[model samples]
Target: MHELIAAPFLEDFLLLRPGHASGVKIRGHHYLELRSLAAEEGPLPGWLCRAAHRRWGLDLDAHGSTREVVLVREPSPYGHGRASYEVNNGCNWACPHCVYGDKRHEGLPWPQRAKLLHTLRDAGVVWLELGGGECTIDPHFADTYAYAHDLGMMVEILTNGSTLDRPQLLGLFTGRRPYRITLSVYGATETTFDGFTQRRGAYRKFRRGLAAAREAGLPLSLSVVVTEANAHEAPAMRALAERYADRVREYTHMSPTFTGGSDPLAQQAPDYLHHRTPFTGCDAGHTSLNVNPFGLATVCKISRDHPIPLLREGVAGLTRLGGIADQALRRHSGCTDCALQQSCTTCMPLVTLYRKAGAPLDRYCQHA
Candidate 1:
């Protein structure tokens, strides 16, 4: 915990709140309330030690103790250092459980896209996450990659891996990038994948893309979003992930329901009622901004109201606006309760899906 606190870049990038401090209060009421899990000099208190994990999203406890949810310093306002450009929402796959099917936003102007990249570069963003509805389909996809590379930032693409074979996709590297390609692979085989993604040739095409990415020397990782169609294949899927090496990761745990544009927690899982949230605080509103295609800084990726135009004013302006700005976010309970609070990304799309799925307990919760 001290190391993270001492790290120059992260310290500047994130604002860690001392437990119970009266510093900038985002939570309704605040005061130091936690006890250290260990002796101060012996080891970190449980809350502080397990504060840097990503597992809170899956309801998995990183702490050996199952007694605590994570908490984090409140997030720095987003769009300050770098902007998260959400290109569009329409995915090539029509996965049965997909919520964005009806809400995918599209058609971004090229200039706006150019300005977005330049803004991130000028801000000294160390990491730029290129995401979708489906990012590769963006008209300026090649230029976007080149621009990110030119800005000298490490990039990570959260893609479904459809058109990796396109000449445009290959042009992203141009021999000057330190990039990571992530595949939101629906499944491990054609039958399994098709059932989950609803994209007929996606599995094969994804493999082709993986081959291309490997040949390009770009690091690759597979992210399997566990759902009804793919849960049973966890073991086999995990084996496949190993083939991709240390980079492959399986993200099981239910997503918030997105159909009809509902919150994931509200709907709950058919037979589950367990709810898990990150233990850390978010840097979203301050440090990480999820920009809509139109360049609006949404309270969340799934938020449809109170759109703050990031390109127009930037993160500092959004901070002045104040609050989550989402009518749908019932409360920010998840962040307050998880142990891995500091390093969690509470993506709104997943929150919406989790709400709809009846908030079922995570099926294979790693903590369990």
Candidate 2:
């Protein structure tokens, strides 16, 4: 006989076989195990154990819960099972380097959005990132965040930190301690920050927002989008973030200019285009799925305009996304045989999107 803890939230991420195991959570830690193990059944499949280790770093044989393993190593419990949804695509700040400007936001209705949350929970999604041009600016932001948390998904918010301290929003973080927020820092000083944002006194508002989040004891993190203007102060910005945030991440690779037109602020560094890494594979539809506010689930945030809707289809549609990715790979036969296959940062869906958009693919083409 094998004993398992009862944790309903982990059912999808853990892949526990029905009738074979049970779930329970104690002190925020989920414990799980097989209901019965016969001598003839042998040990658990090696693939299952390996996947758990790779994605979550949990040792199923150890009998200890993921809570113990993850808390010691990371600040949040967002162990690999992540999916990002753009609650809305409208941003308060017109940052020159923004990536999703071309994709318009239609706004997912509250009823549809609520249903999608339950569908995601059913699909075994544990980590849900609420993002957009800015998640806070969305009218349904509070309701959506509350719904995600209520469904037992570990919620993460990606924002510019300009609205973190609103008194009305304080009630959202009342229950959980592991909730996370990612604040993008433009520069270390008020002058540079305001200049990058192109808004007078924007820096002051940002500082106030960061202070509000810290005071609320939210699990705050900072990210600096490296650009020609702010690259010099990257270190200083990081140090500044360390003062208030629990963690900091850096985005050095600048995004391609959005499809519509040229924005001087959104232009990427020339060097950024040349620095390539091996195109291993993408986790877009397989491990992670990006959903637009219109309730359409595409391969990734960059390819959000694609018509593949996973909201209505639920988790069953993931198989379709996988097939789409496979077809994309087949379309790019040269990628497989290329000498720079190991160093190619471009992926199949991205190549397809660029081709469809009639955009210049040779820019990422190392041969050129």
Best by lDDT: 2
The CA lDDT at 88 in model 1 is 72
RMSD of each: 14.1, 9.0
Q: Residue 142, candidate 2: how far off, in angstroms?
A: 0.5
Give lDDT for model 2.
0.62
- Give residue 225's error in model 2 in angstroms: 1.4
TM-score of each: 0.63, 0.73
Best by TM-score: 2
Model 2 residue-pair collision total:
11
**What is the per-residue lDDT of model 1 for residues 1-368, given as tens digits with 9 covering 90 to 100?**
11121101233433122111111212222112221222122323443334433322222333443213222223232334444666777677776555454646475678877887665554445466777678777777777776765554556777777787666567555354434677776677888887666667778988888777767766677875666567666677777777764667655444543343334233223332234464234454444556667777654455545677657875344664226643333335443465543434454434445444555434212222
Give lDDT: candidate 1, residue 65.
30
The residue-by-residue lDDT of candidate 2 on 177-221, one tens digit each, is 335788899999988899888787888989998888778777788
